[model samples]
Target: MKEGIHPNYREVCFVDLSNGFKFVTRSCANTKEMIEMEDGRKLPLFKLDTSSESHPFYTGTQKSVDTMGGRVEKFRNRFARSVK
Candidate 1:
């Protein structure tokens, strides 16, 4: 371990911008924002676009693509003309 060559790792708040979900965890990232917590304390705030709360895979809202049906239809259409 070297001294004065490592980033400052501290507790920071990550806020999900999509659903307004907030959680605190340790991170070494840099931020220029601050947020007040519920207990009248201020912490470094970081905004995120998506997290486990609103992700499609984690929330079970992912849509299955119908590629097999599309491929079968295309194959039938293409070979049907040649066969006829």
Candidate 2:
């Protein structure tokens, strides 16, 4: 990789808005916001609507689609008259 052609990869803070969970990691993502850390250091802050902390899959709050009571039944009912 060329020296000047590469983006600056540095430590940034990612904050989960829903749960207020924060962690520092290296990233090349651009951010215009800054957040002060515990040690009185400021870093680029990236805010996320949903992360692993509040995500349905990770939190085990995922809901299954009830096709049997929804579109599937409606589709069958609509087409059943045409088939018969």
Q: Write the per-residue lDDT of candidate 2 for residues 32-71, one digit (tens) a residue.
A: 9999999998999999999999999999999987746788
| lDDT, each prediction | 0.94, 0.93
Best by TM-score: 1
| TM-scores for every predicted model | 0.78, 0.76
Candidate 2's TM-score: 0.76
- On lDDT, the candidate that comes out on top is 1
Per-residue lDDT for 31-51 in model 1, tens only?
Answer: 999999999989999999999
Residue 46 shift from truth in candidate 2, angstroms: 0.9
Report residue 62 deviation for candidate 2 (angstroms).
0.4
Q: Candidate 1 — number of clashing residue pairs?
A: 0
Per-residue lDDT value at 83 in model 2 = 88
Candidate 2, residue 61: CA error in Å?
0.5
